[model samples]
Target: MTRLDFELQFARGDFLLAATARIEAGVTGICGPSGAGKSTLLALLAGLLKPQSGHLHFDGDTLIDVRAGHFVPPWQRHFGLVFQDGQLFPHLSVRDNLLYGYKRLSPAQRRFELQAVVELLEIGALLARRPAQLSGGERQRVALGRALLYSPRLLLLDEPLSSLDERLKQQILPFLLRVKTETAIPMVYVSHAQAEVDYLADRVLTMADGQLQPSLATRDAASGLARGSAGL
Candidate 1:
């Protein structure tokens, strides 16, 4: 099993974050309420934020070592991020957005193809449309496609379904399931909703008030909920 070991400490204003975690392959679900440090954790993992003193090792490769003065940039880290809002470029067509990351790959480093990604996310019909023209689910699907096209080693999802309605969430759930089963790439899914974590995660981590803990005791908290009530 691939593993990510982290011991991080960071502070901003009056808030402080002190978290230690070991993430493994498959989905590692992060559950917490709105004010929790869930997003802060993701930002650290994605290299968007640097910890004052910390260590991060993924599969034995050191990504960050504060003592050693080492840090990898987000692009070089090969992490794909999908926010609640798709964040697709308003000026680009869906096809362009999906192909954007694919084009960034070196000629010899190509792993994921555009056609395969399009098919995987079922976004073939929305290729020519712009971001403003697509529905919420459609935009998210395109965002997912674009991220996959980057062929990231890890996928980071921060409430990807939070902005969608019930019907849209239902429509996108199958694709998310496919993302888990069909790809070997690991994922860190961050959401406040326990049901969503239950349906998708292999391991659970709970965050609260800038702290993180393994949810070993409450592992089934979300699993006990009905699928419809879980809301994806």
Candidate 2:
């Protein structure tokens, strides 16, 4: 299994984040209350924020080493990010938005095809529309498709369902499960909702005051939850 090993420290004004983790394949959930530095940790892993000290490695490849002055940029990391707001290009049509990163990759690097992703997300009918034309759930689906089209090494989700209503959350959860079981892309899902994490993650870890707590749930429990939530 692919493993992401890190000992990272970063300070932003009064907030200092220090976290160490060994994330293996499958979904590793980070659950905490707001301001617990969950998103901060995801940012560091995604290369959006640089750690002040220590190092990060992915499958034995050094991605960051502050002492060595080595850092990989966000784009170079090939990690797909899906934020709560589904930051799609306002001016681009759904098709264009999904194709943006996909078209940039050479044919040999394209692991997912456009049709398959569109079908997977059930967004084929909305391709001609722009971001402004879609509902919240639709927008998030397009954003997810855009990421999957890039065939990222890891998928980082920062409360992607937080902005949606309960109904929408239910709608999106099944799709997320499909992504997990179908694509087999490793994921780091950060959410404040314990139920959400418990339902989706193979391993769930709690965070508080910028520190990673012990594992809260096992893979068997999560799988049981998934099996029970089939109607979702």
Per-prediction TM-score to the true structure, in the order listed: 0.91, 0.93
Candidate 1: give the clashing pairs.
none
Compute the lDDT of residue 195 as modeled in candidate 2.
89
In model 2, the Cα lDDT at residue 221 comes to 50
Candidate 2: segments with Cα more than 4 A from true spot: 220-232
- Native-referenced Cα lDDT, model 1: 0.84
lDDT against the true structure, each candidate? 0.84, 0.87
Error of 1 at 159 (Å): 0.5
**Stretches of candidate 1 exceeding 4 Å from the true structure:** 217-232
Error of 1 at 214 (Å): 0.7
